[model samples]
Target chain A: MPTRILKKSWFIKSIFFTSAFIILLIGGITYRNIDDLSKSSELLTQTYRLNVELEQIFSHLKDAETGQRGFLITNDPLYLEPYDAGRENINYSFAELKELSRNNPTLQKNLKDLNVLIDERMDYFQKAFRFSAVGNYNDQNFKENFYKGKKLMDTIRLKIKGMIKSQNDLLKKTQHTYESNLKVTPIFLYMVLLFSLVLMFFAYNKIIRDLKEIKASNEQLEIFKESANQSQIISQHGNWIWDIDTNTFKYSDNLYRLLGEEPQSFESTVENFMKFVHPEDAEKLSREIEKMITNKDLPFVYYRIIQKNGTIRHFKGYGKLHESSDGGKKLLGTITDITDEIDNLRILEDRNLELERNNRELSAFNYVASHDLQEPLRKIQTFLSRLEDKESSKLSEVGLTYIDRIKNASTRMRLLIDDLLQFSRTNRADNVFEVSDINELLESAKQDLAEIISEEDAIINSDKFPKINVIPFQIQQLFLNLISNSLKYKSKDRIPEIHITYSKIKASDDPEILKPKKPYYHKIIFTDNGIGFDNEYAEKIFVLFNRLHNKDEYSGTGIGLSICKKIIENHQGFIFANGKPLVGATFTVYLPIT
Target chain B: MQEDYINIILADDDEDDRLFFTDAFDELRITTNVKTFNDGVYLMDYLNNEESIFPNVLFLDLNMPRKSGLECLKEIKQTDKFKDMAIAIYSTSASEEDIEKTFVMGANIYIKKPNDFKTLKKVLSEVVTINWQYHTNGLNKDNFLLRL
Candidate 1:
């Protein structure tokens, strides 16, 4: 359908061309008509001149005839002189008329007839004049010549009149033709001029309308280009299209701007685009592009580019293999400047490393302080006890009391140091969590505290426990501390009874118990019938160095529960306690199964 | 043949540790002759001397100023002279790495230095009464590292 419309428009254009060609052809015809009209006018002038010369020749013959008649009657030479001059003039006019009439066949025939009649008349006149010039008296001959001359003169007059009448008709016909041709030439020229003017007006109007349409479209194109450029700059993302088969490249305006280059600075080609790429990245980028094409998969890549001003910038680009409308493979993608993001990531990684190093150093410091500090205190207690035992008899009561105080202080210091060391060592130990039976660990803890349990008369009971992945030593320590805690805080009036029960629970079943959303956990609850503190101090009991009773009332450094809490946390679990005044406390520990 | 009394050797850098150790042994009422050395260097010198009497049991202190207990243990285990002797690592540290290392090096026992003299006496008396042959025959990691 479009082709048909195009053909129709072509036809219309050809019509205009044909009209112009026709106008040119008509103008040529008008020019030819004007030339014909001029030639006709020139012919009419020549015919008129011939007729005038013919009349002159006829008059000269009449003059010669009259002179001859006079000379014959009076036999006078003066009359013969007039005849001679008429004869000479008639000959010259006749030759001129014949020369002018040569181009017209009809006039040439008439001139020939007139020339014959005038010659006969001229012969008769000459004969009469010759007799008069001789001075001879020939009356009879002269009388005969006179009658003959009169008859010949009558014939010559008739012939000359007929010839003159014919020449007058020819001249009138030529003049009419000349007048009509002169009148038609201007009308023909005007018609051709009017036709050309109309065709030219139509062509000029069409051109003006087309020019206006072109101007409007050009304005729209300029607006489109301006908006495209603005959006490219705003996004900091530029597009590129490369045709592999044709080796042609088209880069967006922002792409050139990003590379710090002017538009159209050079041809947009792969090699030219590569020139801006940093030398270090060029080979890799080229290889990636090749791989992308062969693999038929688009991959995102990050690379560095050296701009025209020699500033290095990081760019992230991705491209896909696109089959263009022409069935040729094309790479079309966008490049974004990612230098800021890369720098931010680098800084973040560095900070993370520094933090890890500081944490490790701090843990080491704790371990060293706790472990090394205990040595001196142990020695002091050992020596002080020895001194009191070996030299008590010689020392005064004050000295003995001072020695006992020092011994007590050193022992307390030693306990505190040992507890701190255990607390720090929990974090410093190599975290190797293995599948361990909690029941076995409990039994071992029981054995470790067998003497204390027997001395305190504490009853320890528990349900069957499950196996879990945990650091065995830490977990064992946890069990020992809790059991020992129960023994330490036992009621004076009754023997302590500890009931331990464990049940498996999901994170969803008890959301408040586990912060991390693990699938399963072993919720081991230790309910001890001991001298429990107020419920408000339940959380405080787990804090390091937070004791419910004074050092004299309870023998503990107050670090046991905190170590248990630390151990549970290391296994990604939770430990919490609930206590009521004069009632037993319930300590629950959650250990993830996996 | 069974000896009349057990011969025990202790190598430690601290003066107080040596005194506390010998005092604990004296009060323990054990039939044992206790020998003391200031550092692993002196202990190694005494052990390597051809005329010196080898002890029935050797207690090595780990963190010494010169010649660490680990170095001394390595040297003693390499020699055939100290083959019949029971080696024990007695240090202030109960670190797993130290225990495992000494255990692998064929040390019969590891003892964390006791804080109180009473506990120290009990640990020393228990260690002395143990039949060396039985302890060496049934040697395992569970019964190797002892903490008091």
Candidate 2:
């Protein structure tokens, strides 16, 4: 862009110079032509003057010859007086002709020859007059002298006429040359003027075009600066420039606003701006400014500033060295108000600490539940067992029934404690996920319920399974809880048959997986022929300690299915129970593919 | 007959658990000489005595008032005198952490305290009848926990 401007300026300069040169050429040509015209007129006047002088000389000779004739014929002295006066007049004319023809060599030569002829003629006239004065008109010598004198007069007349012709020819030649020069000079000057006018027109057009472009660009710059100001306000930042050469500063209007002041409210100087800096940060910022001045650059520097209203804000500043085309150095800088960001970071840190404390307390509770709570419950059950084993025969029937009830209650308490511990363990975040075989985990769960399976003669059938990513032990527990749930709720009339099936399914394909977190899931369905509860209790059964049947009919602590739900939740999966009264219960689990 | 009987020691903080341990052993048909300590401190003091006879099997309860069973197990495992004696972790709660820690610490087996007298007697007799040399040779993480 600079180069383009440079080229444009160069073109304007060339046009200006060429137009000036052409004007000068026209001026010179006009001056020379005027001078030539004056010279021609002067030549004409000189030639005319020379011709008149020659004619006067010739006429004077004629007067002298005529005077001699009259004096010889009539013997009058008056004619001789006329002859002397004419001679004096002739000499004056010769002097005038000599001055006029001085610059013309040919005219001077002709004038010289004419002078000699006039002299000879004047001498002959005088000799004749002398004879005539002595009354020698009748004498033969006087008569011969008179004829010779007449011939001399005639020759003199021819010489004067020849001089006049030559003068006229010289005047004509000069007039012709002057006329040709005058004719061509006006056309040449007019053409030059026209060319210069065209050149000026183009230059004017280019200047107009360049001015328009500059105006458009200036308007664009204005818009950009306005937008920059708005953006600075929006983004909580400001800009500044320090000219190193001039030791001066220019702060954008937003910079003043950033300092919580009206634009240009104060002088843009280091001291003036420093007055707003927080006392705690002034010294460090002054040092940084000093370094920036010396180095003409600044890295990120953090500081605090107190506004006029006494509000303190955190600020971060950075600058870079910018060298202008004129080789002047400046530091272009930007400062941002980061008070809100800092406060947010501090708030996040506090929240994180609080969360950590809560987690620690939860883990402590898990430990108490697993160890301390179970210990006493185990002793109670043990002592009750000891009582039954050692003294069952001696107890009355009523006392024995009480003992049995106490035993049932203690056993339920143990179950509840163990189940609560399992639920909390599943809540722990330390479980590591690994790729595990679903069939293997199912087999392990079935083995855990092996005794019950054999005693009840229950048959378990399952489809082939694929490996999936899961918390291994938690998934195994999930399988154990669900299968055992089905087994415990089996119909008294029918043998228990549990069918475990596995398949890959899209989350969208399963209506049960509402608000699916993943696209694909590993679907494992446990279908069993059991004494299923009403469908209304499907969701309720998973609630902790929520049981559909009384303790006399079902031995569930209402915790096993809750533990299963927790385990599935820990894996970020979903478990759904579907049941019908006395037909079957289907527990479908969908684990995310990832 | 005294030499032929199996020698056993149990360290538990609970008096009732100590009574249960001795009672289960008394009821079992296996001929055994059983000893019980109220806590790991008493059990360690007896085992550390130069004149005291090292039992064939030592049952260590994890939680105690002072000097927990884990501390005693670590001390006994380090001593050459107790290297040949089998150690069983007998705890009311069979948490995975305790099971893993005791297994790693060279306990021969981990038995969660059963809530019934019958299962307790069964577990004690089975532990007593185990061939120590054969069991130690085949000991692994899967078999470390006495599940039944």
Q: Which ten residues in a row have the lowest lDDT in candidate 2 chain A?
A: A1-10
lDDT of 2 by residue, A46-116 (tens): 88778777777777877876776777778878778778878999999988988998888998898889888
CAPRI accuracy category, model 1? acceptable
Error of 2 at A51 (Å): 4.0
Cα lDDT of model 2 by residue, B1-148, tens digit: 6688788999988888988899888888878899989888899899989988789899999888889999999999899978999998998878888989999999999999988889999898889888989998999988999977
Off by over 4 Å in 2: A1-19, A61-95, A101-235, A247-297, A304-312, A437-439, A449-468, A485-594, B1-5
How many clashes in each candidate? Answer: 0, 0
Query: Every model's Cα RMSD, please?
Result: 13.5, 4.6
TM-score of 1: 0.63
